[model samples]
Target: MTSTAPAQEWPADVRTLAIDVGGSGFKAAILDPAGAMLTERVRVETPYPCPPERLMSSVVDLTQDLGHRDRVSVGFPGLVRNGKVRNIPSLSRTAYDGDTDPALEDAWRGFDLAGALTEAFGVPTKVANDADVQGCAVVSGEGFEFVMTLGTGVGTALFLDGRLLPHIEGGHAPFRKGDTFEEQLGNVARKQIGNERWARRVVEAITAYDRFLFFDTIHVGGGNAKHLDPADLPHKARIVANTAGIIGGVRLWDLDA
Candidate 1:
């Protein structure tokens, strides 16, 4: 049965187990209700052939040292609908043939991630796209806001007047040369084309997205965000800590958030 700790008798400061599942690493930590980390975050390299079962096992192992938590939240690098993963490009063999194990792709598609985590940890669990979760941690909640995460792949999330909009897998949308945003700006692309060229691509992407969305503000995050120079970013954009992934997890349980 699903635990309803957050909606029931859980204390105001109840701890939350926050997991950030990325293409390159799986990280976890304990956070207080206010979204502050209560323990040192731990990370492990994402296992190759990272199907649901293997990913769950790694998450459990990584958080073994963190103390008790009332609930769990996960920020996944994929399309999540009602806690199930619909598409995980970085893990899909069809999308990254050389890096992924083809045999495991189907297992990741349509995986019930929240159900599995609730069963394993015996706590209420919520799952959402990594960028959506990060947006929760930093959005001003005043007007139209956008978030872009630059990591193993690009991720985007939109909010208007503080409410999340229906998710759009814009990262997979074509950006240049008939290639998806991930193909042009993802980590592999940066390595293949060099930082200067990658930075240029990022600038071009920002310009294009501005014209398309016209958001009041855009928060840029993820591991690769650090590689960008502040001066190179647009006036409407600002860099946020990668830790927003972990911190934002708590907001998943906020009914009004």
Candidate 2:
């Protein structure tokens, strides 16, 4: 769904608390209704064995000093459905091998994240996949657009004329050598293989997606985007600011409402 607000009528005084939950970090900021951050963002490293309670506590601590907001919006790095966290891929047991904490991982499954945050912060809240939220900040409202975030893992979002489509876990889909896009292109992979080799994989990823999706434009964002060379990207693809994660949060409320 797309925002109904007219281009010139964006309510300037409406403030929102925008939260971005990633595998490696959690960040929160106060944002103007138009999606620009109004205050310095606060962030903390995501705790390992992040059960729902631990995550919630960290989020609460991160936002404690951000001041008041009329509403809350969250962009989470997982599969969210109807405001609940359906799955947390990066935090799952399979992702950790022997270090896995089954109980903690299970606690995240089906957690009503939006509801919990709303109750804890005393505001209306909305939630969506992190990439879908980022798409809200960057989609140009022309033809088809595809967004990819390469951070702790890969995230994909698609939009048509600025309307976000249903999220697809394309990051988990096989890309090459039986490894998923996340497996081959995430921060872990980049660090493992060195920037030069990782850059090559990113180029390959862009070409592969362009061939299959044929998107008119591709926007790449996330912490790792800074490491990529613009020259290596396709003409249609460009790097976007990491702040898109927080900026896109406000738009999520528009979709939910």
Candidate 3:
């Protein structure tokens, strides 16, 4: 089920189609090997009960007209390992913010997402945890760099001296008050608490992570990151734009190589 588009000129020899699959939306753009976007990003509202095939179709529709793509890169919001979906917090639910469905959860587990996408798009494909892909674009490759994406739920990635570390669903780890970080700092919390206090909580989360990880630098980026107060951010931390998810797609191949 390939989506076709009129061929457009690409500035670089390799044309990478970057897809950022968020819980709320799916965004896509074409990028040069250098990681600069060649097409304006296209986005679509995410569908509920999105099994693996439905998500892939949506992605194909979202990127069909962006331009010709030589390769596909997906930034999926989940724990992906070796092209398989180990766990996906959002799409496995019966509905957005709804209870999880055991059937849906079973469908998503062990799904060969990258292979399915490669077959659908008829191009080579790679899938990584959304935060890991975002981190690829922002990390300086210095010592102990960490990334936390604040959105539908928290997502995290870590690096050591420029080498990508194994992916961990750190957002699901227990934080304060016996609640996971996602329960406290996710979008719902941000909306309910309002940005001012939410921003403070964000700072607090980073502070707690700093104490635990002792990271040399921490980068925060996501759809909701724009609402944060810059002054509240720690000196060792900085905010990056959500576009990092798309731009980092090109860099992901480099990490693999």
Residues 61-173, model 2: lDDT tens digits: 89988897877778888888877777777765433322446776688877888778878888667778899999999888899999999998899999998888888888888
Q: What ranking of all candidate models by lDDT puts the best one first?
A: 3, 1, 2
What does the lDDT read for residue 132 in candidate 3?
90
Off by over 4 Å in 1: 1-6, 94-102
By TM-score, highest first, what's the ranking? 3, 1, 2
Deviation (Å) of 62 in candidate 2: 0.9
lDDT of every predicted structure (CA atoms): 0.85, 0.83, 0.87
Candidate 3, residues 207-248: lDDT per residue as tens digits? 999888999999999999999877779999999989999999
lDDT of 3 at 194: 92
Q: What is the C-alpha RMSD of each candidate to the true structure, in Å?
A: 2.5, 3.5, 4.3
lDDT of model 2, residue 196: 93
